[model samples]
Target: MLPQERQKEILKLLQEYRSMKINELSKQLNVTRETIRKDLYEMEDKGLIKKVHGGAILNKANSETNYDHRKYTNYIEKKSIAKKAAELVEDGDTIYIDYGTTALLFAKELMSKSDLTVITNSLPIANELVNYTDFQVVVIGGTIRKNEKSLFGPVANLGMEHLYVDSGFFGMGAISSEAGYTNFHMGESEVSRRMIKHSNKTVVIADFSKFNTVAMNKVASVDDVDVLITDENTNQEALKELESIRTRIVVAEIVEDEKSVE
Candidate 1:
C-alpha cells in the first residue's frame, strides 16, 4: 500500500476511536511497528495528531484546550491564589499537588522554594519543577487522561499511598454550600480523594467562578477542607457562608494593572 493511503487509513482509525497505539496500528494496517511509528511522528509534526507514550490521539485542541490554555484562563486570580497558598509551605516540606489547572499554578509558585519534596499526578506540574535541583519531584503512575494531561486510576492512587505530606493543594471544579467541593472527571476525583486522605492538611484553591457549580463527583465537603484560597472577586456572602462551616477563607488582594488606564 502507498504511504499516503496508509496515513489516511491511520487518520480514519484515530478519528473513530480518538487514539491508537503503534502496535495496534501496525497490526491493523499490516505494516511494521517501525513504519507505524514513523508515520505517527510525521503526523504529530504536521499537527494532525498528538503522540502519546505508546500511541497517537486525535488532537483535541479545538474541542478542549490543553494545560497551557487552562493555566492562563483566570491568570490574575490564579496567580494571587497561588501566591497566598505558597505562604503555607515551609522549607523541607513534603507536598502533594493534585492534578488541575489551579494546582498547576501552585507548582509554578513553588518553583523558587528550595529543599521540598513534591508528589503529583500532573505532568505539567512535574515538568515545571524539573529544573529545580533542590526540589525532589515524584510523579504517580496511572492511566493517563488525555484531555486533562494527568494521571489517574488505581496505579496513581497506589503511588499516592506511599507518602504523607504537610499539605495537599487541590483544585475543584465547583464549590457550593450543598455539594461542598466537586470535580468534573471521575478518575481525577478519585486521585484527589486519595491525596486529601494522605495529607496532614488540605487546602483548596479555587477562583470566584467555581462557586455554586457542581460537577460529576464530590471529592470532599466544606468540613474536609482546612483552608480556602481565592481572589478578591469572590462574593462576600459566599465567604461568610464558608466561614460558618469552619473553613478558613483567605482572599488574595488583586494588583490592578495601571497600563490599561491609558
Candidate 2:
C-alpha cells in the first residue's frame, strides 16, 4: 500500500483500539516492520500518534468526528477518575477544568460540593456547575468550539492569565512517555497549558484508553503534572512508562454508589 494509505489505516485502527503493535500492523497492511516503524516516526513527529516500544497509539480524538462517540466510551472509568481527582480538591479550593469528556465527569462530581471556585472554558462544564450555585464558576472568555460546546483561543488564555488555582484538572486525547500529553485542539490545548502554567498543582484526568497514545498537539509532559488520576484498566507497562518520568499515578477505584462521591 502507499505510505499515506498505510498511515491512514494505522490511525483508524489506533483511534478505535487505542494502540497497535508494529508486527500486527505490518501484517495487516502487508508492509514490512521497517515501513511501519518509519510511518510511526513520521506520525509521531506530526503529533498524530505516540510510538511505543512495540507499537503506536493514536494521540488525540478526531475532535469533530469522535466527540460524541467518545463521550460515553469509558463512562465507569471516567467517573472513577473524576471522583479521585475531585478528592484532591478542598471545599473552598479554586480549580481549573477543561473541555474533555473525562473533565465533564469531573464537573459532575463537583456538583456535590458547595463551596468551590471552579474555572473552565467548557460550556458543558459551566452548565453542569449551574445547579450548585454555592460554587463560584468562572467561565473563560473565548471563541466557541461549536461541535464540542467549549471555548478556546487567545481571549480564553487571557482570562486564564488573571486567575491562579489550587489545582488544574485536565483531560487528554492521548498521553504516553514518547509524546507526553497530547490533544488535537490547539485552542483548547493553549487553555490547558495556561492552567498548567498558572496552577499551584496540575493534574491530568484520563482513562486507560488514553494512556499510550500521542495526539496532534502537546499540552505538557509528565514533569508538568503533579498527579495522574486514572482507572484500573491502565496496565502496568503504561504505568511504568508514566512513573519513569516521575508523574505520580493514582489508579482510581470504581465505586458503585454514586452518593459515595460526597
Candidate 3:
C-alpha cells in the first residue's frame, strides 16, 4: 500500500482498537516495522495520534479545537464528568473553574447550588453562572483570548495571588504519569497552575480522551491534584498509572439520559 493509504489504514485500526503495538501494526499491514514507525511518527506530528512506548494510540479528540467543537466532541462524557465534579461542591463553597468546554459544563452543573462564589477565567462559565443571581461570579481579569473566550497573562496570575478557594476545578488537554497534567495553551495552563497553588484542594475534570496523552504546557503534577473526576470509559492502564501515583480517582458513571444533570 502507498504511504498515505497505509497511514489511513493505521488510523482506522487505531480507532477500532484505541491503541496498537508497532510490531502488531507491521504484521497487520504486511509492512516492515520501520515503515510502521515512520507512519506513526508522521501521524503524531499531525496531532492525529499519540505515539507511546512500543505503540501508537488513537487521539482524534485530543487535538486542540475551537470552543464549540470541543464542547460537543465528547458531550456525554463531559456531562458525566461535570456531574461527578459538581458532587464535590457544597452550596456555600468558594471554588475556581478554569477555561474549557468541560469546565463550562461543570459551571452549568452548579446551577442547583446556592451562594457559590465562583472565580474563573472562562467567559462562558462566568456568563453561564451570572444569570443565576444567587452565585457570585468573579472573572479573572487579564487579556482576553478572542475566539476561545478566556483570559490569561500576568494580570490574571496576579489576580489569583490574594484569593484562596476551597477547591479549584480545571480541564486538561492531556495527562500522563510522566507529564502529570498539561494543556495546549501556556497562558491558560499558568492560570490553572496559579489556581492550584492558591486553592486548598485541586480537582481535575477531564474525559477519557485526555488520559495518557501529553500536551504542550505543564499545569501541575498528579500529586498536586486532590481529586480527579473522569468518565468510566478511561482505560485500565491509565487508571493504574494514576493509582500508582495515589491520585484519588472518581469514575463518573455515564448515564445515558440527562435526568441527573438537569
Candidate 4:
C-alpha cells in the first residue's frame, strides 16, 4: 500500500484497539517494523496519536472516541445484508441511513438506482452519494464528528422533522431482546432515535455479532423495528429469540456478491 493509505490503516487500528505494539502493527499491516515506525512517527507528528514505549495510543485531547466506520468482522455477511437491504428501497423512496459501516455499504449498493432520496447524518455516506446526480442527498446539519465522519446534536433532529422517511435503515452496536437496539456512541443513538420516529418502517441491518451484545446507549428495541436483516450464521437461539419478539426477520444469503468481486 502507499504511505498515505498505510498510515490511515494504522490510525484506524489505533482507534479501535487504543494501543498496539510495533510488532503487532507490523504483523497486521504486513510491513516491516521500520516502515511501521516511520508511519508511527508521522502520525505522532500530526498529533493523531501519541507514541509510547513500544506502541501508540489515540490522542486523548477529546473525551469521546471517534472511530472511523469501516468494514468489520463479518465482511461477507454484512455485504449480503447491505445488498438485500438495498432491495427494500424502491424507486423514488426517501430513506434515512445510519452512520454505521453496514449502512455505508448499503449506500454504495443504492448507486445503481436512478430515483431515490437519501437523508443521512453520516459524512461518509453523504460523500458516497454526493456525485451521483440521480440521488437527492440531504445531509443533515449538526455538530461535526470528525473521527466517525458523522453529524449529531439537535440540528440533526430538527431537519428530520421535515422528512417523511419511507424506511430508516440503521446499524447498531447491538440488538438484544432485553436492551432493544444499542449503539457504542451516545450521540449516534440520539440521531437514530430521530430517524426511527420519522420513518414509516425501521429496518436494522446487523450481523449476528450484534445479537445479545448491548452497547452503552440504547437506540430502540426489536419491538420498535419493522424488519431485522441478518446473516444465516447467526445462532438459531438468537433467531428464535427475534422470532419470539414478533419482529420481521429477513436472512440475507451469505454468498459473495458478484458485483463486489467484479
Candidate 5:
C-alpha cells in the first residue's frame, strides 16, 4: 500500500481499538514495527493520532461527525452491502429493519419487492418503504432521537412485545470478536436486542469500517447473529474472528459499472 493508504488504514484501526501498540498495528496491517512507528509519527504531526510510548491512539479531534453526516461517508460500500442484504429477503417475508444509514439504504433496495412487511423505528426507513404499495410498514413509536431520526424507549420496547418477524436486519455501530455487536446509543441497542429476540433469523448489515470495532453499548453477541453482510474490504482478522464464533460472514463484492464495449 502507498504511505497515505497505509496511514488511512492505521487511523481506522486506531479509531476502532481506541489505542494500539506499535507491534499490534504492525501485525494487523502486515507491516514492520519500524514502519508503524514512522506512520505514527507522521499521523501525529498531522493531528490525527497521538503517539504513545510504543504505539498510537486516535485523536478525538478527528472523530466522526453526526448520523446524517455519516450517511455520505462510505456511500458506495454501504450500498453494496445493503444490496447483498436485500437479496436475502424473499417476497412475502416479514423483517425488522434497524435504525441506521445502511438500514435506510437496505429499505430502498427492497422497494421492488412485493408483499413484504417492514418493522422499523427509523423515520427515514418507514417513510421510504411506505411509498411502496406492496409493503406494510410498521412504525415503532417511542421518544425520538432527533439527530438519528429514530425512535427508542419503553414505548418502542412495548411495541416489540408479541410482535415477531421472519428475519431481523440490523446496522451496528461496531463489531468485534471480543466486544461482539454494539452500538453507540444505549436506547438503540435495547431496541436491537428486542428485535433479535423476536426474529427467527438475525442479519447484521455493516460496512467494512465497522469491523474490528467496539461501540459504547452492547447489542448482541457475535454468535447471536445468523449472518453478517459486509463489503469486500473487511479486515482478515475480523473475518476470522467471526468465523471462530460461527457467525456466517457474507462479503459483498463491489461491482463496477460496465463501460461501453463499442
Candidate 6:
C-alpha cells in the first residue's frame, strides 16, 4: 500500500480499538515492526495519533494527555481540579498517586515541593518525580498495562499492602450518584481500591465530565472518598446530592487567559 493509504488504514484501526500495539499492527497490516514504528512516528507528527511504548492510542482514551488525544476535552477544568488537589498536600508527606491523567497533573504540581514521599503505580508519575531530589518515589511493581502505562493485578496489590501513605490522590473514568466512582477497566479499579485502602485520606480528582457517567467497574463508593475536588462546571444538582451524602466537595474556578475575551 502507498504510505498515505497505509497511514489512513492504521488510523482507522486505532479508532476501532482505541489503541493498537506495534506487533499487532505489524501482523495485521502485513508489515515489519520498523515500518509500523515509522508509520507511528509520521502519524504522531501529523497529530493524528499518539505513540505509546509498544503501540499507538487514540487521543480520546484518557487524561494522561501524552499518548492520547483527550487533552483537548475539559482541559481548563482538569487543570483547575488538579491545582486544588495539589493544595491538599503538605511538605514532608507521603502520598499515593493513582494512574490517571488528572492524577498525573497532580504529580506535576507536587514536583516543585520539598521533602515528599510519593508512592505510585504509574510509570509516568514516577518518572515525573525523578528529578526532585528531596522527594522519594516508590513504584509498585506488577503486570504493566501497556495502554494506560499503569501496573496492576496481584503483584501490584501485594506490593501496596505493605506500604502506608498520608493521603491518596485518585481519578476515575466516571462518577455517578448510583455507582459512586467507576473505571473502564477492572484491573484499574482494583488498583484504585488498593490505593484508597493504603492511605489515610483519599481525595478524588475529576472534572465535570466525570459526573453522571458510568464505567464498567466500580472503584469505590462516594463514602470511600474523603474529598471530591472538581471544576465549577459540575452540575448543581449533582453537587447537592453529593453534599446530601455528606461528601466534602471542593469546586475549582476556571481562570481565563488575558488574551481570551472576558
Predicted structure with the largest lDDT when compared to the true one: 3
lDDT of model 6, residue 74: 69
What Cα-based lDDT does every candidate model obtain? 0.82, 0.82, 0.86, 0.81, 0.85, 0.81
Q: For every model shown, what is its TM-score relative to the native structure? A: 0.73, 0.76, 0.76, 0.72, 0.75, 0.73
For candidate 6, the per-residue lDDT at 38 reads 98
lDDT of candidate 3 at residue 197, scale 0 to 100: 92
As for candidate 6, its clashing pairs are: 59-68, 59-69, 59-70
- Clashing residue pairs in candidate 5, if any? none
Model 3: CA > 4 A from native? 1-62, 259-262
Give the alpha carbon lDDT tens digit for every residue of 92-171 in model 4.
Answer: 99889989788888999998787898999998899889999988999988988776788998888787778878999998
- Model 2: colliding residue pairs: 59-214, 59-215
Q: How accurate locally is residue 49 in candidate 5, as Cα lDDT from 0 to 100?
A: 78
Against the true structure, candidate 3 reaches a TM-score of 0.76
Q: What TM value does model 5 have?
A: 0.75
- Evaluate model 2: give its lDDT: 0.82
Q: Tell me the spans in candidate 1 whose CA falls farther than 4 Å from its real position.
A: 1-66, 257-262
What's the lDDT for residue 4 in model 3?
79
Q: Which residue runs of candidate 6 sit more than 4 Å off their true CA positions?
A: 1-67, 258-262
Alpha-carbon deviation at 71 in model 2, angstroms: 1.9
Per residue, candidate 2 scores C-alpha lDDT tens digits across 1-262 of 7887778788878866888999999999988999999999998876677788999876544433556766767677888898888888887888888897888888887766768898888898898887687998899889998877889887887787889998888888778887789876767888888889989999999888876666666799878988988898887898888888888999998765643322
Residue 237, model 6: lDDT of 95
Give one digit per residue, the lDDT tens place, for model 5 in 25-85. 8998999999889988987875567898988877654454588788886788888888899
